[model samples]
Target chain A: GAGVSQSPRYKVAKRGQDVALRCDPISGHVSLFWYQQALGQGPEFLTYFQNEAQLDKSGLPSDRFFAERPEGSVSTLKIQRTQQEDSAVYLCASSISGALGGELFFGEGSRLTVL
Target chain B: AQSVAQPEDQVNVAEGNPLTVKCTYSVSGNPYLFWYVQYPNRGLQFLLKYITGDNLVKGSYGFEAEFNKSQTSFHLKKPSALVSDSALYFCAVRGLQTGANNLFFGTGTRLTVIP
Candidate 1:
């Protein structure tokens, strides 16, 4: 089976520009999550989706960050007016369900560099 | 608040020697702990997790983690280190009682297995 995949492995954007990163979760996965990882730091939660519903977005750092999983399979994280501080890898993960014990499968992530 | 800490920035070990990566966590209720590994230019891969029951949990690639409630630690360990095992390791934790299923991750420990 194909693992979770992210597009545009690397993206360089100018400050104030908008960028969108895409993620394709594993087939049939019902739960999807997005995270942000800064250089030399751990990943921080961004948002979550159970099917088409955006369950949680509290982890999103700012209003500039927006995420959508409308169809429940593919997801996109869009950053508006990107800042140098937004430079980091955006990771996407999916799981079978939101059960207490389900494991998450992660993607390689899209590294975004804002200058 | 749920949080995780990987005390060490890096851990170096000789091949065939025992290796340990320290991880500590804090949460309001019972903690669901997990370990993940990331190689350079790659996505994170699930290593193992501790939900409940047994204190010792075995994971992929001959890795194991010990859950200590008293210490609030879930350190990853392996009897013999392999050169290929070198990578960035992250420890994550989530409160079982928290309605939102989000993981709090540590800064990550870079493990270097010298051959």
Candidate 2:
């Protein structure tokens, strides 16, 4: 089976610009998660979705960050007015169930560089 | 609050020698611990997880993790290190007792297996 996939493996954006990263979860996955990883650091949670419902967005660092999963199959993480501090690899993961114990499959991630 | 800790910034091991990557966690209640690995320029891949009923959990690529309730540790181990095993390792924890759907990740540990 194909693993989770993210588009635009690398993106360079100017400060104050808006950018969108896409994620395609594994087929039939019901849970999707987004994370941010700074250089030399582990990933930090961003948001979560169970099907089309955005279950948690508390981990989002600021209001500039937004995410949506309209149909529950593909998801997008959008950053408005990007800042240099937002430079990092954005990761997406999906799991079969919404349970905390379910194994998550991750994608290669989209590396965004804001200058 | 739920959190995970990887005390070592890096671990170096000689090929054919045993290797260990330590992780400790703190949460309000019983936790579900997991291990993930990421090669350079790649996404995180699930290695193993400890949910319940077992202290020793075996995972992909001859890797295993031992869950210690007393120490609140889940240290990843491999009997014989291979150069290909060199990568960044992450430890994650979620509070199963509270049904928290979020995973708290530790500051990852870089593992270098010298051939």
Each model's TM-score?
0.97, 0.98
Q: Report the lDDT of model 2 for residue A94.
A: 95
Restricting to chain A, the TM-score for each candidate equals 0.98, 0.98
Tens digits of per-residue lDDT, candidate 2, B1-115, equal 7788999999999999999999999987788889999999999999999989889999999999999999999999999999999999999998854354577889999999998
Residues A1-115 of candidate 1: C-alpha lDDT, one tens digit per residue:
4999998899999999999999999999999999999999999889999999999998899999999998989999999999999999999999999876777899999999999
Scored by TM-score, the top model is 2
How do the residues A6-92 of candidate 2 rate in per-residue lDDT, one tens digit apiece?
A: 988999999999999999999999999999999999999999999999989988999999999999999999999999999999999
Interface RMSD of each: 1.2, 1.2
Off by over 4 Å in 2: B97-100
Best by DockQ: 2
